[model samples]
Target: MAEPVRVRRLTDQEGQRLRQIVRRGSIHAVRYRRAMMLLASGGGNGVPVIAQLVAAGEDTVRDVIHRFNEIGLACLDPRWAGGRPRLL
Candidate 1:
């Protein structure tokens, strides 16, 4: 079986930043969701519980946690391809 995923330990600054985003309610919805996931994980909630609390799929919660572990707070706003792909 695969090991469960979780966000790494958060510094005081990172924790404060996430709380600000969640409290202000002005950040992008996607970022808000990601921040919530990391905060819940840091608070000791497992992937499944976090998914239910956030009303998201288990896979999505897992992805957010893993992404946060890899990129820290930057995972909140991901950079995706903006333009259409060209046929090679």
Candidate 2:
């Protein structure tokens, strides 16, 4: 069997910070933070485990992890790039 992915553990302060984010952040942000926390803490280390825990797809979990690793916390926010600009 393939070795399971190793997850980094969050510090107590980091856990508290994540809880605060989940409590006060926007819907998208909260969801992402919660998932990240779960994954980071080994609550669910693999994509399948995380997906089942969060009721999200494996791809979604992978994407969130990748985004957070690459871009820090800002990836939690849902950015809707504005539609095409109107010509003056």
Residue by residue across 49-69, what tens digits does model 1's lDDT show?
999998999999988888888
lDDT of the structure predicted as candidate 1: 0.88
Per-model TM values vs. the true structure: 0.85, 0.58
In model 1, pairs of residues that clash are none
- The local distance difference test score of each candidate is 0.88, 0.61
lDDT per residue for candidate 2 within 24-70, as digits (tens), equals: 65367556555454445356567777677667777666676666666
Model 2: CA > 4 A from native: 1-14, 23-44, 84-88
Off by over 4 Å in 1: 84-88
User: What are the clashing pairs of model 2?
Assistant: none
Give lDDT: candidate 1, residue 34. Answer: 86
